[model samples]
Target: MSKHLLCLALCFFSLKTQAQQSDFSNINFTKADAIANKYKGATLESLPILSYNLTSTLKTDVEKFRAIYRWVCANIENDYYAYLKNKKTRNKLKKDSLKLATWNAYFTQKTFKRLLKEQKTVCTGYAYLIKELANLAEIKCEILDGYGRTADVNIEELSIPNHSWNAVQLNNKWYLCDATWSSGIYDLNHYSFKYDYNDGYFLTDPNLFVKNHYPVNTKWLLTDTIIPITSFLNGPIVYPTTFKQAIVPTQPVTLHLEVKQNQEVIFLLKEGNPMDTSNITIEMTSGTYKTSVKPTINKNSDELLEVKHTFDKRGFYDFHIKLKEEYLITYTVKVEKK
Candidate 1:
């Protein structure tokens, strides 16, 4: 498969979600959230009624959409086993287009059954349900298939599309969101679903959204920045908290890096808010042995933070940054003796 080119139409949707600027601040979601909480355990028998119950009393398009989005995130569970199976099959059949297409077609049916009956699904099911509910409410929403980059995704092995999200048109403007990421996280240690609602994925900023999500269709890219597939793949692995905290990694554009002993590597970020530098910590792991470091954090300004860490030893290491004990982003580095 050829590399998917990305041309984000940044100019067209700048005001919609530029950097840290959000148009949703003034819009109160109390009513919509309350409604979602009230209807916490809704079934999927009738989408129209679900949509109506979620939106009829809501005042605005965004609020209406929020109610539906929140309800789905809270009620539905991410099928981790199914997700693993789909990923394995997709990777195995990636080289054969015919077989891959056939498998996708067959699995889609099973996915729907699991979603409707058990309230469990993967990314595709989440996107489908969102689109169906939005369509029932006469809201403009679409399912977008593309690559979703997490720490586990090997860029070299990315062939078939591995994820799906949603694009919404509200008030004559386009917005992007991923209910799958927002719903919760899969506990890797225990191998179970953890219900942690992250609202950052709701109508996310295109600039930050492009960090991990690349839609198959260029038109869905609301930002105008031209990001190549290589850059998208090489970028650092960002977690949901990265978006929630409005922290964008500006330096070390690539995740993998090489440096000599005693060489210094700089980490830069554009913060959405003035964060306490003391709350940040960098942990480096080389194989089973792990160690933590307190890098010198300097504020370029209220919104720009810089971190400097020098490699004193030679090894292949994985670096993780945490803010207030929440994971923000990760990078891999190789240090060699001079």
Candidate 2:
């Protein structure tokens, strides 16, 4: 009986995942996107009315959720200072659960007040607003807090829960998304938020999503594939452009690598859509010097992009795969004397 129950559970999980991964080739998002743009700068005071305005005209739950997600991404400004403050506080209070909980409680109230007044927020606010709006529209949604890997985060350890995203159930199937990241990017040089909506974060593939986002609750990882947190922490640094191109780093699993000078390292990226391999190049930087090198790129029959590069000099180098002149996934390697 136990073995039979186990098989039944496994079958159910497989079916649930397949249902969420349905192809939406026929679902045109033009109307849904337009509706979200139509009501730009909408107030958050009456969530029921806001939800109705966003979803009432849409026929499908996915479209309804898309509208809500898009509007939040476009309208909300990410407060970097607020995020930094929260991170500092969380890290400082990490050893004390009691103090951490108190700070979280106080910060939650403070966060919402500012969110309503200034239309600015962090990841938690984005996820919360998405959930509230979706729930009001009679769509099931949830806020998932977890570790979000980025260039700024230390790859050596998973210290604290540093980020939050959302999961919505459309047609009884769960899909993952990140409105905060989709909203825009923070320009460190200018010290301001740039409102550039990244469409890739919307209804993202679970396998690709797990590369950067690791939910605190493993069950929220919609895919059946198991990705250990250690692998995620050591993975390549992905930027917003990485998702825009629908590329996944499949080789050299870890971001930091040690290789002998003159030794060739093969890096691979799986593109969701095939592209011209000629435009791919690598930009290598060491200390104060930087140069661009066109590595030997090979496109296999399986759509896997192979970037083979050899370091001729002994030095620590920070390199990135440049796609159409824009830097994508980042990796670093230490080259020792051959």
Candidate 3:
């Protein structure tokens, strides 16, 4: 059989086996039933026939396939990675090889149900499972091979094909989703599962993946715009002050400021107590005056407050602000220098 035909056969066979093994008695098929009921007028009796008999199904088509696919994705747990990583539980998965070579070899011998029952498989195994489920739901999906880069690391430097994920067609548009990435994995250094789901990476903009992910087949990327890692890492710098000059009277001007991305600021005066709130307030003629301000923390913090004052008298004020944190944040303007 042709490769495409073989893949299709595997997909259908997996679905048939999964349906037979699935314990639907425990599942509240009410939703699925309700979805199926929409086609009550149709003559189809079974799911497979209804799914493949496009002419009849499309007649009552309420897009139940997408619903079923989403439900499965939401319900399935990606625990293989975590299970293999734990020393105590890792032994159980010993039968299931972690090596990519072993996984590639298994796909040739095992069907989806067998691999799933073994509770061990590699990236290809996971992708195959996804394909199986998608096929059952009649959702068009494809497995794409690629390398995933750590947040700051570059994939181009890596020598091995380290990751795999899925591309799903929804609403006539393809999106990338990584179930493995969705599952929190233990970072050896942190010793805890860092559970962060970046939907942006799931079904991402083809342009954005080019800079980080080098798919075996570039066609899967689907976009020409290459977004640099720096573009995502280095964001716009929001200066504390948007204005270089402001009109103020010497009485005592209070400047209220906030920073975005939750950054903290430390206000310093060249001639006043750094901690003294009163000293931070200065009186000058009706003109602009310059004061120096700096941030203390190197990371963004929650919303905070900092107050600066100039008396009713103002002159040309020159103030300098230095970012103490290396994150992008926004500040709110509470007080006006004018």
Which candidate has the top score in lDDT? 2
Q: What is the model-wide C-alpha lDDT for candidate 1? A: 0.85
Q: Per-candidate TM vs. native?
A: 0.89, 0.92, 0.40
Of candidates 3 and 1, the better by TM-score: 1
Off by over 4 Å in 3: 1-73, 79-103, 107-115, 118-122, 152-156, 187-198, 225-338
What's the TM for model 2?
A: 0.92
lDDT of 3 by residue, 1-338 (tens): 99999988865444222111012224443455454345433431343554443222332212443333333233334444433443233234445657545654544355344444543344555566556556655567888887555433331244244467777665444555555554334466855445443333334334334434556665565553433434322322121111111101111122223233223234321211112222222222223534333233221243223433322322332222322222112211322344
Q: What clash pairs does model 2 have?
A: none
| lDDT score for residue 121 of model 3 | 43
Q: 192-228, model 1: which lDDT tens digit per residue? A: 9999998878888776787888878766767766667
Query: What would you estimate as the lDDT of candidate 3?
Result: 0.39
RMSD of each: 5.1, 2.7, 18.1
Ranked candidates, highest lDDT first: 2, 1, 3
